[model samples]
Target: MATLNKSVPLSAYTQFSRAEWAKLSQSTTEILSALEREKLGGIDETISADEVNDIYLPLSQLLYMHMTHSVNLHENVSNFLQKKTKKVPFVIGVAGSVSVGKSTTARLIQALASRWPNSPKVDLITTDGFLYPNAVLEERGLMKRKGFPESYDIGRLIRFLYELKSGYAYIEAPMYSHLTYDILEDTVQKIIEPDVVIVEGINVLQVNKKDRRIPQVFVSDFFDYSIYVDAEEEDIRSWYIERFKLLRNTAFQQSESFFHRYRHLSDTQAYDIAKDIWTTINAINLEKNIRPTRHRADLILKKGAGHRVEAVHLKKM
Candidate 1:
């Protein structure tokens, strides 16, 4: 773990170095196949067997324990009330800054979680789907701040989660397509009685000013556990720029893609645009919105250079 900052109070968290946390992974089996490992990683992400064994396996193990405990607790409370026990999906929120590889982490969790001995049904959803359409963003003058809190339909998201935890067997969440850079009209991700649902987004841990008042409610309220992927701001900015360059040759080449115009840009132009986007928009969102919620996460995975997690922090019970 990064040395506990003695200057600030951290009594509510237990910090562990990467090696210390890895020791807790008791599962000897490798659950991810080679193709799956490649598919699960993002363009700029480094997802290796070592990372899965050391960081993610222990997390999945811990999540299973939490799920088991919650199930038992529900049964106990139901028994005391002389009522039937209703099951709810274990909700795990993965929150982080853009380019921090949160989506990859969410997919890894869903993958490992579903392969548990009991074969639990796991579903993963990204808040990008909940983002207001690009046209709506343009009309609202928020196109530049598309990933910020105001860009999301918080009420709808809350309602979906509300229904999910209420044990709705068939729930549909809106879907977005990055290729078009917009919400797919009438498209939805069907979440059918999942044992676990992983919600991934840049703002999953955010608690807006209005939410801090009495009768507080936010996305984190629906999470049984949450993970925050952390790295220095400069590192994240570099990753964002690198990913943009890579996408220029890949996703941006398609004529139907929203970013197709960028394919013809020279390296210098691409770099400049990517840097400007980071400095003017993404970085501001990170500092003002995302980073502020880091400590609010149940688990914090702090990364070092090369996108490797070097420390872990678990919130004290």
Candidate 2:
């Protein structure tokens, strides 16, 4: 685990040691049960009750405070203008490299935030739902760059966010299936007046270069607060390989799985394929797209080799 340099002058963020950050969790209660944590855990990602208490508990407490303050600010502005206004959802963007546990973090935060008295209606949506269908990607010859920004339906995703922020009565998001490894054309997730919306993905914080010439808005612009999960590149690669192996033994064994063909491969063959995918696709995307936007986040959760959050960096206001 890397420690912050106390002797050096900090510019953008105030770094907190894991022990120091755990103290903030004192004000928040542990509402998640063992079963809930297990359900929220990502593939091959270890998230014990202790990790939740030390990392996510404090994070949830801080997010709730931010939500409360934002509501009060809105109310004050509305009263100053002598007008009544409807409340909009507070959007939190979570961005990180693939297999970095951003999904797990988003789910955990959603659960904790819902339990908070200030915001009871919480919804979690991944930008994976906004990815173009495999058929479309194949047509565009972008199957290799599936997780890249250019591979998404950015225009549609932007419109959805605009509608969500505009306080629309109902918004429908397309569904993506992991089993089929494609966007489901017939299914949609209906979001109805949520108090909080957590959008998690590899490219949530990315600023699209294609939108530069136009007045189109990036997804991060709609976020009230954003989090970027961080870890060493090598550590993330190892985790990705481990997850691939686990899936090979479990999900890949199912005939319906997209990667079912790999189930019959030997351990060495499976390892080579996972390594190739990580190097050619996931790692390249991380270096080129995801990591450059880390500084844009309001908070950063830096993880160590074992996928534990070893330190926290809060952007200085």
Q: What is the C-alpha RMSD of each candidate to the true structure, in Å?
A: 2.9, 3.6
lDDT of 2 at 281: 96
Q: For residues 1-317, could you state the per-residue lDDT of candidate 2 as single tens digits?
A: 23233233346899999999988887545568888888999878767877888989999989988999989999999999999999899999999999999999999999889889865799999999999999999999999999999899988889999999999979999889887789988899999999999999998888866546677578999999999999889899999999999999999989888899988888899889999999999989988888888888899999997889999999998
Q: Which residue runs of candidate 1 sit more than 4 Å off their true CA positions?
A: 1-11, 210-214
TM-scores, all models, native as reference: 0.95, 0.94
Instruction: State the number of backbone clashes in model 1.
Output: 2
Kindly list the per-residue Cα lDDT of model 1 for residues 1-317, writing each as its tens digit: 24232245556789999999999999777768778899999987858889999999999899999988888898899999999967899999999999988888889998989877778899999999999999899999999899999999999899999999899999999999989999999788988889889999998998767544577679999999999998888888999999999999999999999999999988899999999999999989988888878878899988888788998989988
Clashing pairs in 1: 1-16, 1-17
lDDT of each: 0.89, 0.89
